[model samples]
Target: MGYQYQLTKVILVIIFWSLNEVIPIAWVFLICGASLPPLDLIISKDKYLAQFPWELYLFYGYAFYGILFQAEQHLIFLGIGYSLSRLVLYFQLKQSLNT
Candidate 1:
């Protein structure tokens, strides 16, 4: 997909996800189940330490960007996660192939 299209889709999903804060963390559970950490895990909680069942309710309160207490903190953590993953992917995927 084009970058703009992808971004718009992501924005919409984010908006939809944030629209209903009453889901009870169903997405968080599903995300964790799929070996993905939702935005909340990176900020106030550790991904490894989060329990699937119990954190479900708590995660429901999270915003689209996983803002439990502070939105900026959530955004910072999300950027951190993205940067880390990008670095990993760069080293493991691109750099490794040349080595």
Candidate 2:
């Protein structure tokens, strides 16, 4: 009975800790994904907006989150994902302009 109780407690602690770390990362990705399309539309409609350094602002925001949360790995992954998505958007916009 004692061993079983200890095992259960350990499992619960691990689960909760994992969730605490995961939930924020999941939220970041979810919000970024949801916002991208609308932002892309707005930027596309306004060529001058594309000239703005929006990506730098995003990087600063991500860096702020990292500083606040002390989650270096999450910040690195977020930066990579954001850069790739922005690159894709840039190429798509360039192509559209050419046509």
Candidate 3:
């Protein structure tokens, strides 16, 4: 799971960097900054961390960022990537729990 998480982060960085031609540097920074906390939370085993609503925060944060910047397309792309990353984390966590 740790390796997978690291890989996901690396992949996301690559994807975002490649989008530098399209997305502004500020947007790229915002997206990456907004994503790290939730990713960190996903790997934590703390009971308090499990109880926090990071998902809602991530969604709302992205929405707010998009609206503020008036970038719906970037928002949508961020949503898709974010959802896929969360799904990967979810499955990894679930597998670990079941074992």
| Two-way lDDT contest, 1 vs 2, winner | 2
Ranking by lDDT: 3, 2, 1
Show where candidate 3 strays beyond 4 Å.
1-38, 42-71
User: Which window of ten consecutive residues has the lowest lDDT sum in model 3?
Assistant: 44-53
Best by lDDT: 3
Tell me the whole-model lDDT of each prediction, alpha carbons only: 0.41, 0.56, 0.62
What TM-score do all the candidates reach, one by one?
A: 0.35, 0.40, 0.41
Tens digits of per-residue lDDT for model 3, 1-99 = 678578658966885788687878556755764565465664554632244336657776777787788766666556655655555655666677779
Looking at model 2, residue 81 earns an lDDT score of: 55
User: By TM-score, who's the top model here?
Assistant: 3
lDDT of 3 at 88: 60
1-99 per-residue lDDT for model 1 (tens digits): 265445544654664477447554544333323322333233324332422344333334444445545564433443444444434433454454467
True-vs-predicted CA distance for residue 36, candidate 3, Å: 3.7
Better TM-score candidate (2, 3): 3
Stretches of candidate 2 exceeding 4 Å from the true structure: 1-40, 47-71
**Residue 73 deviation, candidate 2, in Å?**
1.2
Clashing pairs in 2: none
